[model samples]
Target: MPHSLLAVPPSRGGVVPALLAEGREVTGSHLRELAARLAPPMDAVAAYHFGWIDQHGDPSAGDAGKAVRPALALLSARAAGAAAEVAAPGAVAVELVHNFSLLHDDLMDGDTTRRHRPTAWTVHGPSQAILTGDALLTLAVDVLTRVPEPEIARRATARLSSATRGLIDGQAQDLSFEARVSVGVEECLAMEGRKTGDLLGCSAAIGAVLAGADEPTADRLHTFGHDLGLAFQAVDDLLGIWGAEERTGKPRWSDLRRRKKSLPVAAALERDCPAARRLADLYAEPEPPEGETEDRLAHLAELVEEAGGRSWTEDKARALYRSALGALDGVDMPFGVREEFTAFAAFVIGRDN
Candidate 1:
């Protein structure tokens, strides 16, 4: 019952992260309050985007995306010894910024659906969606600044601003990769960090800053978030190529069609296999007619698997997750909270959509 897709993913096996329910409850309340404060059409647009209201302003249970990032933020605060109530603003700010990125990204990527629902840009038109995204980003900062303590507010804002800048640069790198003839695995990995990891790193550590946590604690938490984000993106890349359109709310083979040079593709290209060469050939050709695309993409997917792209990416994801959880060693926190984190990390890597 929230908007925005996952930094983690949808809960499964009934293993919801600790404080996730509280995170959703509080973040949802704040989001609704913030949406009400926006101007007339923008408020309506924002509400529609969040699945709180339909295109005609009626309520719907349509795909609202999982509220994983906000939950993670609140968990970070709880781990750092702050009450969930006290750190709610930090959680909400992280949610807003993430959604802002989604709004722009959906439009720029020309994605038509997410979570089995029409993307905001498609329903409301691209211009309105862009403006709404801009509004959400601004709102995130405003929410942070409203925190009662001036120093905490400043620290939170600065950390978030730095992350946003890195995210933008990552976006640039991502787009540039699409136009290039070749890309390296290491470079794509670095780009993935900037685009996906930086904000998540901020989300993980921001609550610590808000709670007046020391530098060492915040830094380790940042690493926790950053590595987790990379693991999340690996799953996303797999979904982009192989996910069911109905389950993922994305067009099938969208990434391969775009020849976007995702991790799998980059790694596969490095292989010395026949499929690798053919996959490269396919990537260079312009997309065929819509009717012909499915089989072509299917073959392309097979080739990627044959070249061992899929398996490598999966192994890398699990490895990144291990590194992420390893960052928590010696971090002072509740044992229960630490247990919840381990379960949550497992859940993130295990989620199918």
Candidate 2:
């Protein structure tokens, strides 16, 4: 069984769960109502994705990723000194939007596995998968519209729309980078900032704004979210290269196999090594032999280290964590919230899965 929320320390000064609990109280009924309105096929697909049903819509067991976005929404509200429970619908809306993106991204990437199970696209066809993703996006908006105030709903929708557009832009850049021979660390960071960072930043900012935070306060929270997100992506990059397949549930050397232009690869370009040169040579090769693939993978990792990718990533994560914590430095945090937030940050970077 997955670890219970009660098992782990909170991520943001023991505020994550208090906020999450509030959102959950509102969300359970709201989500069930929304789920009831979805058409059968679409409902089946979404239910499966949410771990509420099997591929055939029968009851089954599955799991979802940490609802990080929702936590951000709730925490942002708390940071602004509001009852985050009052903004629960907004929190659920962001979570739905995030899940919708994950569904579409899995289809676009032809990724078969997620959370140790076949992705929606893997079991269903691309058309159904695409429809499912679209439906989720629509549901997110629907959830936002029910947030009890037209103006709040409108602002939340606008922010979400912008975040979604940024995600697409980032994904486009990521796919395009695969074909380009020259990619740099700066470009990689920009791509991640847009693709991954913006959504996270917006989640926190929108929450704060909805809770009536001043512009400066909201902006600080936004910065914190962006830094945390960038650090999260760096950790993810490291896992993609060296994480255990059993833990990560991804194919070993998956990035290398795809010739992905990740941060480590960008770092390696700064060095002049035979292995680095060989990686450049092999980039365009249609298919590399196993022996050669292993050799190249090992060398590329070495080159990345030599070029200081790991050190840079570590430093960046630490700096971001500090910044995130600093944002809360003088704020009167709720009981145990600080410890939870610190533990959460460490868990994110230290995770092998």
Candidate 3:
């Protein structure tokens, strides 16, 4: 397959560039300010995680993540006919919660690197990482509760709390899935909806709420974000299996090595094909192939593809991307703002990392 097959086409007329620039100029500054409010050591860890600093506590420019959630929040606000700045608090809150999950997820998964740098848990110790994650989660609430309008603040806080709870429950499910021998594609999709979609949905909805959008508009944006999140997760699972170490900042075939029941693997396992049965037998082993781990993993990736896992996941991602775009039909936004939002949805599934 051509490399172009890997990503959704870039949005026409440079909408992605405008959205990314706005995201950095608007949301990035506020994210930094919020990180600075943490206590010294924790602040440094947060900065490092955000890619503003290196492991030795020195300044180093690194790629923070794509900033998709904050961008979604900002764009949703604009799509509701409000200035993007009106949703800054929503952006900050969602970004904080996102980093909180990253910090703890790295620890839980024993991941040593992210964004091409050492993970916080590895550099700061798991306990410190856990505390930093906790602090970030609390700060999300603090920032939202401090919004100038009491009623808006209350609503935003409630929405964020519900999303965070769903995220935690999803994480619990993910960990449990790792230990189980079988996980259905439907169950995995539902878990992904909670683990990934709920937060993105909340981010979009919170922005609309902050902008005082009508209930129907907010619900539509929420659905858009939710579908986009699922598409993003599907693509991420594909990358976890086949992405380059340099591009993904992790070991090759990391998901296979860990036996993660990600969407692709679950889809493959659910198949009635011969390759699916063989893949299941490999997974049932108490240990990975002792001497040929690399080759075994390579074969496993082939099995997943042969079992129709790859095509199923790719088709699902495309379908969800369409569903997400369709949700924007009646959003009542400016043409330019709507284009930016569409471009962002494309970027979410097309991102390399």
Q: Best by lDDT, which number? A: 3
User: What Cα-based lDDT does every candidate model obtain?
Assistant: 0.83, 0.70, 0.86
Provide the lowest-lDDT 10-residue window in model 2: 1-10
Clash counts for all predictions: 0, 7, 0
Off by over 4 Å in 1: 1-18, 290-292
Candidate 2 lDDT over 221-326, as tens digits, reads: 7777777778778777776666667777776666676677787777766567765666667665766554446667766666656666656666666676677667
In order, what is each prediction's RMSD in angstroms? Answer: 3.8, 4.5, 1.9
What's the TM-score of each model vs. the native? 0.93, 0.85, 0.95
Q: Order of all candidates by TM-score, from best down to worst?
A: 3, 1, 2
Candidate 2 error regions (>4 Å): 1-29, 289-303, 327-343
| Full candidate order by lDDT, most accurate first | 3, 1, 2
Q: Comparing 1 and 3 by lDDT, which wins?
A: 3
Please give, for residues 236-303, the per-residue lDDT of candidate 3 as tens digits: 89889988888898888888988899998999999998999999999888663454378889999999
Error of 1 at 132 (Å): 0.7
RMSD in Å for model 3: 1.9
